[model samples]
Target: MANKIVVPIKQVPETKSVKMDEKTGTVIREGVDSIVNPLDLYAIEAALRLRDRYGGEIVGISMGPKKSVKALKEAVSMGVDSAILLSDRAFAGSDTWATSLILASAIRKIGDFGLVVCGERATDGDTGQVGPGIASFLGIPALTYVSRIQDLSDKLCRAERLIEDGREILETSLPAVLTVIKEAGEPRLPTLRGKKRAKDLDVQIWGNDELGIDPDKIGLKGSPTRVVKIYRPKVARKCTIAEAKDEASVGPAVDRMCGFLADKGVLQ
Candidate 1:
């Protein structure tokens, strides 16, 4: 079988600076700097390295709003042979479980891809659930938290899986799904030639119907979970505004800060 590898990726929020829309209570991704989920970069790097060693096509697939094209472009600039954007308004509020089902459907339709790789989790969700979810839906074995690709062949592939305690070497068959960790490998820098190529090549866009996906099995209607609510972590700013003619007023501000931390159990 030819080595046709697919990497599933996402553009995730800047966890340190996330803001939520007041009305929707969902993350305000607009105007925020989104990065290729770091973990996915590892997966992509793994796929690219494999493709480089053994001749094959590296396909990048992502599902998100139109804005998510930025992430796909970055992958293309890293030498991915093909890319697919799966977007639909009907997929608005899908949680991990629903998202996995949609991706599983899309993967099934990709026809000849031999290996599928994904990040262990998205920085925003941190669910670490989607990779395995896709595996379950597709009825395939999944190896996750992969730190290194030990050895690979068309029929059998081996990897070093990172666990909480240490690591383990695991082997699985060709059609297996892999969820990679950041420790797997560093992602490659985009070359001038690769970037130019990415700019010219059109990324294929797929809708639910194009994937031959049933509405009842995809988007909101087919999703089994929902985002009941989303919100930003409130940051309390401490400003004295103390019209203090002298430095003495700093005492109240200091005491207030100390008390706040004490109440929050951040200080003893």
Candidate 2:
């Protein structure tokens, strides 16, 4: 049997278009449009491509508010074999560690999945920490910032990870976690058949109690870090434009700048 690949995604508020309250520093997400994260598209595409090549089922998982089903529907329309949404009031305000613990619990419930894939980070949080957090919670090997996944034989999986200085190639056993960056591949368009199938396909929705996660440890209570405040940065610009009409004026222009700096004590 081919290995089953699972990809978990999220629907986040379009922070790009969101306006914040300058006084409170809280996003005005109410009535704002939500969309499936761009990075998650790469993870979903990777799973589908692996399934097509290796002959397995590609399962899509997501966590968010009740409205987040829209995100999974989009995934289903992209040819995922099945979709699961984890939703509940208790899941609100969960940080990376708590969120990963809840997701890991759901993964265990699904059972028998050989590989897990995820995006490098979510645009909303920009933490880039959940993928590795999931791996740590599950005690599985995780290779993140993967730009390329070369091979996925049941024998082994080889991938190239992008680092700041260069790339690192890694090989890991089956049942490992792979976190893909957007550069991994261009996601495929949703097919008509896939859209039709998604119409009737009911995505399984899991709750905190159903997944058997410790209530206290799977939500805000479990998060250690809290943002004391959030604010938009204010930037001040100081620029000088210099012009020299002829070669003779170049020396004078340079001297003018030097004099300005010297008078300001910027140059000693």
Candidate 3:
């Protein structure tokens, strides 16, 4: 099996406090509490498992503002061998396509990796496109929604993927990208020793200068998609109370319920 694995992670606003700037079509992260994307923890755990079994180095990478270093440190505390942060003003407002391109560039700089692992999706974006996008940029196979790694070798990887109906087993060449689902396993908490190591770790920070990405093709300027608008969905409900104080009223109450159901097309 390839001895070096790369895991791409994200820092996201706490779900409950997530907000968007309608004008800019970007998440409002200022003053918001952030944490390592929960789903990404599974990816970290999976990479750690692979490294433990195969004996390799696990490198964690993240693209965000300087504050995002927190997320990388969290990954390191969970046993990542080291971590790197991709931060720069030019990287602001990057969509999945641009984000993937930047990450792929970083991976290229850390070349000779055997595999790349990622979370199924990021809560803030709720889009699972980055994993496959990275694979496309790297010209490697992309295995998504993978719940388990059945087997691994220098030239091949067999995994169990979660599908709509059930699970599917497939094998792909090494140096592929895998988007891990929660079913893979529960992530472990950071141990005291790991925490100590992470505290002293000097995470590397790379920017556009290091990646040498074209300024016009690295952030909002490079994104092909845009959020035109965002609004809370209006949920309107009408409550109709049908009282059945006695047995004599039960039939009428039932009829009313059925009528309401029919009116709403719930009963066809």
Candidate 4:
């Protein structure tokens, strides 16, 4: 197994502040504070555990604007050995496919790596596709929804993954991708030393120029899927209160509920 492990993370708007542009069908990130994608914390924790058990360097990578360096710094503060930020205007508005392509290219640039760990999905997109997409681009096995790592070696990884009805164990060769789940473990908080190191670390920045990926296969231009429309579902309800202070009012309350249900066609 190689001595290097890569964990891909994302910066996302705080859940409560997330909004969408109905016209553009995109997230409204302006004026919103962003944090490291919550699920990705699990991925980072998993990588850290692996590094602890076996000796390896954990590298955190992210693709976004220059400001996204904050997320990388946060990852460093969480105990990653190093971090890289992929920033370029050419990478704006990338869909999952385009994103996976960009990240896979970066991994190739990093050269020898034994494993890639990622979160099950991003909260914003919630697609759960990038991890598998990276595996597809890298021509490696993709084990997703991983809950636990049972064993690991230079050549192979055995893990437990969640399925619809239950969990199943899977063994895949090295140089594979694993999309971890929350069951892995809770993420650790950053320490004072880690924070100081993060402040001093010079995070490397790479772009399309460095990765040399085809412009036609990146950003919005390369995306095959598009959001045509975005709108919030309307939720409207009418409340009717029938007081049953004593047994005398119980019969009327039941009759009122039945009538309301019948009117709504729910009692048919």
Candidate 3: regions farther than 4 A off: 232-268
**What TM-score, over all chains together, does every model reach?**
0.82, 0.84, 0.88, 0.90
Query: Residue-wise lDDT of candidate 1 within 1-268, one digit each (tens)?
Result: 3458888888888777677666544566778888889889888899988887777898888888888888898999988888888888776656788788888888888857678889889988788999999899889889988888878777888889988899999899878889998887888999898899888888888876686666676565666765566656797987544343468877886777778788789999
Ranking by TM-score: 4, 3, 2, 1
Give the per-residue lDDT digits (tens) of candidate 2, residues 189-263.
Answer: 999999999888888899987987777886666677666677668878786656789999999889888988998
- CA lDDT of each candidate? 0.82, 0.84, 0.93, 0.93
Instruction: Output candidate 2 Cα RMSD.
Output: 4.5
Screening candidate 1 with a backbone cut-off below 3 angstroms (N, C-alpha, C), the clashing residue pairs are none
Q: Which parts of model 2 are misplaced by more than 4 Å? A: 19-29, 232-268
How does model 1 fare in lDDT? 0.82
The most accurate candidate by TM-score is 4
Q: Which candidate model has the greater lDDT, 1 or 4?
A: 4
Q: In candidate 3, what are the lDDT values of residues 60-116, reduced to their tens digit?
A: 999988888889988998999999999999999999999999999999999889999
Q: What's the CA error at residue 80 for candidate 1, in Å?
A: 1.0
